[model samples]
Target: MNGLNTTALVLLIIGGINWLLVGLFQFDLVAALFGGQDGIIARIIYVIVGICALYAFTFIPAVKRRHAVE
Candidate 1:
């Protein structure tokens, strides 16, 4: 559970940064490295990141637990 949460968090951060780059500079880092939006690798990365964001949603319970501890 800990590992999954950590992985999800990392992926989520990556996705967030990617979005920031897009919004600020009109650049798509993931697509650029992987070869554009239609590229196979880029699509896979988008899917993986999307899944990670969804998975991270489950961490809300863990977050509550941590805050409760404090």
Candidate 2:
């Protein structure tokens, strides 16, 4: 993938891992690293990740098309 896709995928992975940590151990890596959930930096990161998730949905049709070709 290109740079934007790679960045989005990485952020998605980070978000996924954060969710896993929250599910299993009640931890939030991003908040802990940046500050608490209410911290400005943490909130910015959360917003970016959410935006990336929406961007990722745009890939679904391409993925389906690729799979259908195969």
Candidate 3:
């Protein structure tokens, strides 16, 4: 709802797309931007994305449906 949450969502979406690309084509956009997969910056970006993903776990659509019924 706020900027931090929105930013986290965007990062998570980007992470998801990057995974899709990797799974389908062995490509990784985050690694490309932060420099190869082994780079510290790339690893940090990955960690942030991972954290964002964990943060988003509570926001999944199925929970929204359950909450709506209550």
Candidate 4:
């Protein structure tokens, strides 16, 4: 995958892990590491993760095309 795709995947993984922690233990890893949930850095991370999730949608068509070619 290209760099941007790789980055989006990594960030999505991080966001997924953070959600898992929040669901299981009521913890917010990003907030905990950066500051509170309202902290600027933490908010930025959240926004980036959300955007990456949207970007991930683009992969659906690519995957379909790849499978069709095989």
Shift of residue 65 alpha carbon in model 3, Å:
6.1
Question: On TM-score, who's better, 2 or 4?
Answer: 2
The best candidate by lDDT is 4
Q: How accurate is candidate 2 locally (lDDT)?
A: 0.97
**Per-residue lDDT of model 3, residues 1-70, tens digit only:** 7887899999988999999999999989889888899999999999999999888886778678989999
Per-structure clash totals for the candidates: 0, 0, 0, 0
Candidate of highest TM-score: 2
Please identify which of the two predictions, 2 or 4, would achieve the higher lDDT against the true structure.
4
lDDT of 2 by residue, 3-59 (tens): 999999999999999999999999999999999999999999999999999999989
Task: Write one digit per residue (lDDT tens) for candidate 1, span 1-70.
Answer: 5787778888889999999999999999999999999999999999999999888778789789999999
Alpha-carbon runs more than 4 Å astray in model 3: 60-70
Clashing pairs in 1: none
Q: How high a TM-score does candidate 3 get?
A: 0.80
lDDT per residue as tens, model 4, 45-70: 99999999999999999999999999
Clashing pairs in 4: none
RMSD (Å) per prediction: 1.3, 0.6, 2.6, 1.1
Off by over 4 Å in 1: none
